[model samples]
Target: MIKTRFTEMLGIKHPIMLAGMNWITTPKLVASVCNAGGLGIFASAAYSPEETRKHIREIRKLTNKPFGINQILIGPGAKENIDVAIEEKVPIINYSLGKPWFIDQVHAYGGKVMGTIAIARHAVRAAQLGCDMLAVTGHEAAAHGDVATSMVLIPLVASQVKIPLIAAGGFYDGRGLAAALVLGADAISMGTRFILTQESLVHDNFKQLCLMATEQDTLYSDVFDGMPGRALKSPGAEAMMKKGFSLLQSVKSALEVKRMLNLPLWKFIGLSWSMLKSKEGKGLLIQARSATGAISHLKAINEGDEKEGFLFAGQSVGGIHDIPTCKEVVERIVDEAEKRLKAVGKNVSA
Candidate 1:
């Protein structure tokens, strides 16, 4: 097996991770990854606190291996959901978008906190904040990513931080895994690649679309979720880009979010105000757009509504063409990485 600090730190057999894709990384998918020897991160941002607890228990029933939950710290229910995870003594808690104040709480229970960062400077800040590890996202990633690609971002962050680094974005196969290690990452996180697996719950229609996509088939824009992100070039995605921000749609979408989370009107308002005042200071418009994006994301995953829905995808979609089992994907990547590494060693000697 191709072991690295990521594998040793997490007590997993492989230095691979299932990137947390909101709504896509369900209990089953997470468990499957853990069982396959890679770290699976349950996406807690899509569910309420109660739902989060239920799913955490469900994953436990499915696998005894170490696993994690990924939370977007700037949103509502983030604190509540994270509280539930800590109460359950989860193995790892991964967060993004904002600072993690509960690092000590997690570490108190012997759980590790992984910070996800898109910027090189943010990697340094996260390391300083006691993050046990960092998931460095590049611009080629699915969902939210900033300006730098993995090529520039990985080595840059590696030079700045001493903690284990998980390279995310544009990674698909063994070659990519080998390259990530060579670039100084401890492991590689794959979202788009895992989404094509048989264990994934993504609609077959969207899977087919991903198979047909080229590296150029993605569009990056703020319209996807009011924050800059990358998504597959679809009719819904294109329409959103043309339509721009819509206040009316955002209000309607925010209401849907409130109902989905089972939050009372006052509580929902409080959360909204808190988000605005948070360190990120995303404001109401961004939250509203995020609501709209969440609904569309559900449509794409649950109903496969291509015209009205869009799925976040990375440039690596072009390299994925088959729907293999999670175990097969993991094993294949490890085998390929080993061979590639040996080949590189031979070349150096030659």
Candidate 2:
């Protein structure tokens, strides 16, 4: 078996991780990955605080192994959801977008915090902020990757920080895992690959679409969710890119979001105001776009609506050919990584 700082840190058998895709990483999927000896991260961005707590409890019932929750710090209910996780003494908490204000709280309770960043400078800051590890995303990732690809970003961040790094984007197989290790990453996180797994809750229609996608089948733009991110090329994605900002659509989606979270009208408005004053100054436009994108994502995952819904997918979709169970994927990746590493070692002479 392959081992690294990530595996040792998380006490998992393999140096692989589920990428915590929103609406995709449910309790079942997360527990499956944990049971398969890999780190499974439940995405809590789509759920309310109560739902988050319920899901965490469900995961514990499914697997006694280590698992984590991924939260987007900039989203509404982020603090509440994180608070719920900490109250439950979760083993690990992973976050993306905005700074983690509860790192100390998590560490105080013997929990680790993982910060995800797509830029090298952010990696240093995250480590300085006491993040236990970093998930370094590359431009090839499905969502929110900056300009740097894994080839350039992983080693750059590795050279700048002492903590373990989980390389994400453009990684889908054992060859990718071995390559990440050589690139100075302790592990590799796979989003698109996991979405295609047998245990994934993604609709089979979208899975088939992903399987048929090529390396160039993804589109990256700020239109999808008011942030530069990649998504599978689909009619919905194309329409969003062309439609630009729609005040009416955004407002409707915003209301839908408020309903989904079951936030009091005053509380929802307060959250929006807080976001406006946040360090990033996201304001309501971004929030509205995000709400619309979230709905579209659900349509693709739950209803298989290809015309009006789209799924975030990485370039790695090109390399995935089968929908194996979580266990099969983990074992295959580790075994392949072992063979590739040994073969590469033999090719080198001192």
Candidate 3:
């Protein structure tokens, strides 16, 4: 029953949100979260525009509750995906990696745009761009994250932005949600926590490893995709780190990703060229590093290749001990947060 600006704005009963994890957060999982009175976001970055539309419709079929779509603004077909979301009038459009070009278009349809940022300064810029909300990611997050931990970055961005903030990275339970609220976030977004859930499509081996992990079991490195990202320690990930790069693997993975997204060869080449010309895409080294992680992820998540594959995880891996249903996860978080808040109220009064 906890209500914040985020919950009210989205008309949801709780402030918990499932991070739009590529390949992991499917329509079934999204619908489960939405039906459980929390926000469920589908990762649209890995799919083609037609696939994105189909998933969106699938989510609609599963639940009448509000949901969202997350698109990586720097990747191939990013523009096409954005257009698909706009045309479908998706309730919430979440963008990461770059500035959104269609904020006004989203607003025109009464939709909200949420910008995900890891750096404190980016929050200010995203707010300036008319983002309705912000998902501030901390270094403790799985996958790609900035160096600032949630403790410092959440409040830092909160001070500078007027929009409601959704704190991400290292959040796992009700205690984390309560802590995020205290840190000035209106809500919290979790990726790894949701990945270990029953609804998640990740392989059982991956889930078991996370349950067995401690904070030290994860490493943050650029080996996976040449950019700094946090992933579980594995032979494959370790190899990437030692070698300092993965040229052949990256090429193969890039082709796989291209095929998965149904991106034509010309479009793929054009996308690569465009990225190379952009400020973020300056060097070929960055490109090489960035290209290797996707297929490894697919190997681990879809094929159960734990030894030669990468599993992006958060530092919260230390705190998670079991695989629960989405409903259980959300309910436990809400109940714990309520109790903690009440206890704090009493302590303050005393």
Candidate 4:
């Protein structure tokens, strides 16, 4: 059996984690992964405080095994969602997009906080902030990614931090997990591969696109969320690339997010101000100015309107082809990793 700091720390059987992709990592998917011995993380960025509670309760009902919640630190309802997780005393709390402000609070309740970073410097900072663990994302990641690939970033950050690290980007199978361990990561986190699973609620059209996609089928641009990100090749994405930024469209999207959150106007403004002050927001000030990307993402993932919606995808889509259940996926990955590891050991002994 595969053993690593991630598995030991989380008390799970395998060192695999499901990426918390908004609109994709539903309660059903999370429970399935937990039941299958892998960690499943629920994406709380798109959920209201009440919705987050409901999802957490649903997962509890489905499985007594451990699970986690992922929250975007810069989202409008980030604090609210975090409160829900803390109140629920979740086993794990995963966060990205901004520095965690309530790390002390989370730790006070015996909850672990994992910070997701794309670059080496951020990994060091996260470790310094007492992050229990880190998920280092490479450039081949679907949505927001850094310039370095997993091959380069994982070891680079691992060398600097003693905390357990999880590698992301362009990882789809057991071979990838084995390779990540070799590069100093304790586990691997995947988003694209999980999206194609039978339990994922993503429309079939989106799944088909990922199945048929090639490495060259994805393009990177700053058009989606006002920051650099990767997405599958589609007419809508292409059009956005060509059209450049539109002030009117951006404003419209921001309004749409406000309505979807159902937040009071003053509350919305306060959230916007908090985001603006964050290091991530300050670095990408223009991108943080509007919420158009949120609208596009909802449309694409939910409506499957490829012509007008934005679908954030990772390059790992190129490696996935089957629609297996979550249990099948986890078991297959662990089995393959064992096979590959044993083969390597035999070769070295011989």
Candidate 5:
């Protein structure tokens, strides 16, 4: 293994990361990745502060090794979630969207902040904001990200930012990790690859579907969750593509969002106004505002609504075939990456 800056910086044995996918990254999954020497992140964006802490406690129970928490800094209850992470003393905080005013707070406790970005300007801003590292997610990532592909964005951001960079999007095998390293990232963050693992909470049917898919199976559309995202196109997504069909999904999704946020219109509208006041804040707020279908999509994931709800996935699904445990998944990637890196020798640089 290269044992590059990433491993030393994070005090982990491998330079691999589990990208946070809401609801799908449960405590059991997080512990598995950490135990295997790769960093696993729990996605707390979909949870209330209490729930976030609950999951963190569970992860701690499973492993004493370090793990991270991924939070959407502008999502509903973002501040509260941050508070919970800090209070629980997580080793790392991974975040994206909105101002990074909480960086100082995280640093105070010796916890590092890893800001995720796809575009160049955002990466520069993150570096300037005192983030300890960066996770540059590209178009191939499962959820919301800018148009830049990992091939183009990775090196570009690396050239501009001084902090360590972790590449996300379409990373599965060792060659992908080598490619990420060649592009100037110290580590690689994976989403779709790990989502298929047995430890992941993604539906078993969905995991099988990913393996059967091809690179062409995925697409970027606002139909599934209203904001631009990549996913497997099911009947619900196709129906949403039809004019006026999405509006109904929109209505149904909004009802669920309100219930989840516990907002009673007046409070929701007030928070909306606060988010719109700042340019960066507005972008995140607008995305979340359009995320009506996202809340409903979870129903598809956990409740088996398959044909009627959204299922967020990446273009990488085509490469997934079996549902291995999270440790097996991370271990396989690390093993493959080490073999690939070792075989490449000096020509691979580093």
Candidate 6:
């Protein structure tokens, strides 16, 4: 009875969503989150068209519940991955980095498109582009924020967009969800909080660090991925800060993402340039920063070198202390939310 628009809109039992973390949200993890009553979002940015489908099938095999896919539209093979998702008739497609040109296609299939943005302007752009929902991520989010924290960004975007909004960043507890609802968001998405779940497949070392973190432990640095993203203060970030951008670094970083996507040279070059051209303004500068920072982004996923690799994280890491199962995590937050809502209702009645 404490349902929000998120539950009604997505047709899910709970309002919580698992943010797609690259190299971390495996099929097992995705299914676990879904089974636990939260919307599980698989990170398809790390996979190709076929690989994405395979994992989607794998998750389906584990649970009959609905789950979404997170697609980083700026990376190479992004278009192809989007095509595959459309063809497969995925339930929800969450995208970041660029405008979605395939919204109509997804709409035809009854699929929802949700754009993730850290800044208010981007949120407006996402709504204009016909996204069904907005996941308003803030600077306190683990990765890639232009500006604005959750408290400011959510309400700003909510004022502009007609669709439902989900708040991300600085969210890991029932209090965060209550605050987001008060701010006009229908629900909340959990990145760091989901990562702390037992189902996540990340490095134990990194997980340990996350457990030890506090809200103050996160730092925003362009050295992470040629863009300002939030993450735990680590030695890798420190080293990258010492180095600066160069043409060689730029090409290398582009190639790393390309290799991951298995994209041909022409498509890779064309799309990369296209994103830069469309973004224009400060976006071009953010794209340029990728030259020195991109390698660290990809390397961090591979566990190649912590000294050079950067982990995208959020300020909420400090608020987390244990690795609960996905179901427990979801139920805990949802239950708390329901309790608080009912308590507030009683006060109103009184």
> Which has the better lDDT: candidate 4, or candidate 6?
4
Task: Please write out the lDDT profile of model 5 over residues 133-155, one tens digit for every residue.
Answer: 99998898887767989999999
How many Å off is the CA of 95 in candidate 1?
0.1
User: What is the per-residue lDDT of model 1 for residues 1-350, given as tens digits with 9 covering 90 to 100?
Assistant: 88799998888999999999888898899999999999999999879999999999999999999999999998778899999999999999999998899999999999999999999999999999999999999999998889999999999999999999999999999999999999999999999999999989999999999999999999999887889999999888888889988889998999999899998999889989988887674778888999999988888998999998999999999889999999999999999999999998988953
Give lDDT for model 1.
0.93
Q: How many residue pairs in model 5 have overlapping backbones?
A: 2
List where candidate 3 sits over 4 angstroms from the true fold.
Answer: 283-288
Question: lDDT of each prediction vs. the true structure?
Answer: 0.93, 0.92, 0.89, 0.87, 0.79, 0.79
Note the clash tally of each candidate. 0, 0, 3, 2, 2, 6
Candidate number that wins on lDDT, 4 or 5? 4
Worst 10 residues of 6 by lDDT: 279-288
Q: Is candidate 5 or candidate 6 better by TM-score?
A: 5
What TM-score would candidate 4 get against the native? 0.96
Error of 5 at 7 (Å): 1.3
- The C-alpha RMSD of each candidate to the native structure, in angstroms, is 0.9, 0.9, 1.4, 1.7, 2.4, 2.5
Q: How would you encode candidate 6's per-residue C-alpha lDDT over 3-88 as one tens digit per residue?
A: 78877887888888888887778889889988877788998876878999898889989988888899887645678888888888
Tell me, by lDDT, which candidate is best: 1
Off by over 4 Å in 5: 243-252, 263-266, 281-291, 346-350
The residue ranges of model 6 lying beyond 4 angstroms of the native Cα positions read 280-306, 348-350
Clash total of candidate 3:
3
Candidate 2: where is the Cα deviation over 4 Å? none
Candidate 4 least-lDDT 10 residues: 281-290
Worst 10 residues of 3 by lDDT: 280-289
